[model samples]
Target: MNASTTQAYEPESHADQNSKNIIESIIHGLDTFRKFSRLYAFMGHVAGSFFSSLLAVDNLSQLNPTFFNGYLQYIVPHFFMHLYVVGLNQLADLEIDKINKPYLPLASGEFSLTNGIIIVASFLFLSFGAAWMIGSIPSFWGLLASFVLMTAYSVNLPFLRWKKSTILTVMSHVIGMTMSFNIAAFMHMKTFVLKNATSYPRSLFLVTVVMPIFYAVVATAKDLPDIEGDKAAGIKTLAVRLGSKKVFWFCVSLLQIAYGAAILIGASSPILWSKLFTVSAHALMALILWNRANSTDLSSNISLQSFYMFIFKVRVAIK
Candidate 1:
């Protein structure tokens, strides 16, 4: 009887082990999803512009489940698009990333190249298909432009790898970001949601124009942390040409100037609250940037990587 009991317990224990393995696999997959998709980055990239347009149009009063569902509809494809953009870069820069970002799924051997290709291709199709189905002209064109530019930026081909040129790289980033983040988002809200005469609000116009300058800083600053890999890979990023320390300070000064401009614009606002709020927020932000920059150790790889992430946070905060 004791032998029979042990035999029965063994089967149950084996079954429990199988169940645990399945659950652990799922958790691991989710973790990989987070790393690959960079979901928070997507939020920072699109959420501000998307909702800012809605806010400008006074659409908050229409809040409901349906509104949120529509929001999901709009963002899901955009998120997939973001995944494709970043993933393609990783795919193309596997060697460079092995040096600069070894922990990335592709470079680290956690996710296979075949799997990465399949997923990225699927995301590209999904984004384009969803855009066509939604029938948003601005979004479709903007997505197309981004697809082209990012492909050119990453893929090594005859006369195609735009990342080798600082001007082309910066232009790609600025144009792609402005089109996808500002113009497409705002126009989608205008043409699809509002469904009336087209007009740009003061806030939206300012964001649209100023966003390019900010994105230029973002583009240049991103390369600062990748100087080693980029230099080895023959990429001519500003960080490579000028040295990381010099490029770092240059990016900081550009952002500071942008903040100063924002403060000036806020002061010119007719409303007292707008003036007070904008001026105060930008001033605080500028101070925070300088403090962070002063503390950063330019020589340390870890410090440079951390500062790169801090730059993303600043982008989201400003948005």
Candidate 2:
């Protein structure tokens, strides 16, 4: 071919190659999103925000058009915050996850360490920026608490890895989740009534107290599945300190306590139908959890993971 002809073909080839690269990048991004379980995080924030809003208003009527707008405002920032936290945890635990959770994007080589870092940093920026735009006290506190807790849980800088300590791990999850709940509640109040935001209700306080026990169960049960990785990493998780069997029973006991408390609280309700339904529900849940606990295979990590998800189901029921 002549020089002019060759040059013309070269430009076309370059354009095709660039287009292919762009398509590949988009596909890889989607795969990374799937591996990171972003959908579950999104749904979780939705449910948490909804429940918190319910607690704040204490009536179904308050869930009007404005409630949804406020919800979107709250969830947008919280969603990015959740992403930031999860990404940071994955980045910090890449090696450990390679052993325990090889399917993760970072551990599986679907996303490079640099890619993960960029994703995390971007999410962190977006989380804070969205929170600032919301401009509510609850939004500010939620963002701040999430930053502090996630930093303590994941960031290894200055060795603040709270995951290495069982108590610290549980406390971090409890406090972080509580802050998340209250953030939602505050967002609802700010949206509806800026001047006189509702004070923290007694019911929410009780929820904060009881829910942490379940959070502790989830925290420890999660470790039961990753015992090998945790042990190798010199992480003193509760499941590492106590045998998996013991940890399993410990979680079961916590569930029982939580359900028992729910039953007692339900029994004292003034409304007869509410009392019967709540008490019956808790009783049934406790029995079902006990039965499942009995049949669960403590030796299998998958089974333990399933049980952990079951705890989440029970938590939703309680809510």
Q: Write the per-residue lDDT of candidate 2 for residues 1-319, one digit (tens) a residue.
A: 6998999899999999999999999998788797785465446556665776666665677678766777777778888888898899999999999999999999999889999999999999999898787776677687778789868998777769989888888888878877785555555455543334467765576577677777677767878899999988998888899899998998899989998988888788888998999899989999999999999998899998888777777777677
TM-score, per-candidate, Cα-based: 0.94, 0.87
Q: Report clash pairs, candidate 1.
A: none
Report how far residue 288 has shifted in candidate 2, in Å: 1.5
lDDT of 1 by residue, 202-294 (tens): 777657666677888878888888999998988888888899899889988988887887788788899999999989998999999999999
How close is each model in CA RMSD to the real structure? 1.8, 4.5
Candidate 2 error regions (>4 Å): 1-29, 183-195
TM-score for candidate 2, residues paired by index? 0.87
